[model samples]
Target: MTATTTTLRVGTRGSALALAQSGQVADWLSSTVGVPAELVRVRTEGDVDRGPLATIGGTGVFVTGVRARLLSGEVDVVVHSLKDLPTAAADGIALAAVPRREDPADVLCARDGLTLAELPDGARVGTGSPRRAAQLRAARPDLDVRAVRGNVDTRLGMVADGTLDAVVLAAAGLARIGREDAVTERFTEDVMLPAPGQGALAVECRLADRHTGPYASALARLDDPVSRAEVRAERSLLGALEAGCSAPVGARAHSDGVRLTLTGLVIAPDGRRQVRGEISGRAADAALLGRRLAQRLFDDGAAALLGDLPLRAAAAAGGG
Candidate 1:
């Protein structure tokens, strides 16, 4: 198989972390397939606005621009954090690859080196995601959770300055930018289930849009088949729930040799109650595993908890 040596544009959001992740993708593509790939920085509406994310459109404001560039042929490939990709696929585009996954759980970045348990009552924990915020409240109902927004660096700075006692961040985002030191503690699966597809990368490309065909295929060699299956199941759960990306839902999927297991949760905003369910099935029926989990939860009263969210949850928090 021949590799493409000509220039290939890879579009990515222009955040420090986004660029770093994109650079890693470019490095993998170039070294694995002999394609000369460069990162094309794109400014997204999410990056420009400092307002509340929920008030603005919640359709992953970060990845839309990059996807547009890919659709227009301005870039041959676009790499995005899997959590940022919508459950709905775009027309003319395919999620060609999912290149493994990192720690999918949220991490706590606290001041004075305190863990979630060591923190005092009424201590402020900052987060923008409803799932994290609801989980924080559930874990420590006495603590205060403020909605926070910004790039990873900006949010971490709040803890550094003592404005916030702690913050919840995606472990993968911390790892991508060499900011693992920012984490005071990694939330365990039992305590805080991650957002669906939280730690993987989605490689999007047009259907049969090959740049030096065989080389393109080889570069995609980085995709991990098992991780792809896990994310598919988790995303299917999200789709079945009809919850937007901002909804207070948490899901995780794991596969052993014999079966795939999916655990899902829907939390009320006040943290007093939540609905949880799990399902196991043949690995080949991962999507069914997710749907089954959803059906069980709904039958068990998840709909009442998530229905009319305001009665179930609080108003959105913070401006970034």
Candidate 2:
């Protein structure tokens, strides 16, 4: 159906967090572009699998299934947790926009409103992300870091039930689902840098619709330049490192309209060895800045730290 005559079908994973974010996008399209938009839930492999993310294909697991729906013309647009998107671009699909971003910091949901530092020695903390596990271990080597998987509520329930003393989650995810009050403490970048593109939403459509369709204008207007630049820089570093989304890698970028600053980190899964680097350049050079920083990280021995990861990449000429 033509976008002009029919409602814009926005495809999304059926998870509560996904629906909340996708619903926001759909509502925006309806209100801003005057096009009726509908939510079309798509079940993904990641949703069905209870296995650890890295073992089951990491970053692309949550994305591939929903993207297939977009490619098959079943939906006009798809919304994704930007962190779940692979650095590789999908053929025939366009990342039409990255709307305004949420706070990308990760937070600790601990019992007794305790902050990270307040946790007693040997405290049990659960997280599904290797990056978070590494950083958490690094920050408090005495504490126990456990791998746990489930939806946000399930993870949080573990804490409520005393199964886990605490859990680490994306601040944005908690915010989107109206559970911000559960956060006991927000980790600073120095303590726990976030995953690249963690707090953003990706709006994608078929490549052809990007420049010539009823949705084109709305997509263009939806893109926030600063947010896009920030994520581009972060994702570029991830791509340059050749690391999968579930790798023990963390990056954060900020663009203040004119200039951009990016930081990249690579830590061993065990949190013993790590390398971190930072770079700044023109905001327009976000991607270049990322590659440059990644190269710096490699030069600082980041590669050795990644050797044991499930997904490892040899160091290459950065900014190639």
Candidate 2 residue lDDT tens string, 220-283: 8899999999999999999888888888899999889899999889998888889998999999
Query: Each model's RMSD to truth, in Å?
Result: 3.8, 2.8
| Per-residue lDDT of model 1, residues 1-320, tens digit only | 46666776889998888898888888888777666788999988788887766666553777788889988989888988887776666778778778878889899999988999999989999999888888888989999899999889999999989899999999999999999998899999889999999999888887666443444575458788788889888988877776666778899999763578899999887877899988888878888888888899899988887786541222122111
How much is 294 displaced in model 2, in angstroms? 0.8
Candidate 1 stretches greater than 4 Å from native: 210-215, 310-320
Candidate 2 residue 224 C-alpha distance from true site, Å: 0.4
- Pull out the clashing pairs in model 1: none
Say which candidate scores most in TM-score: 2
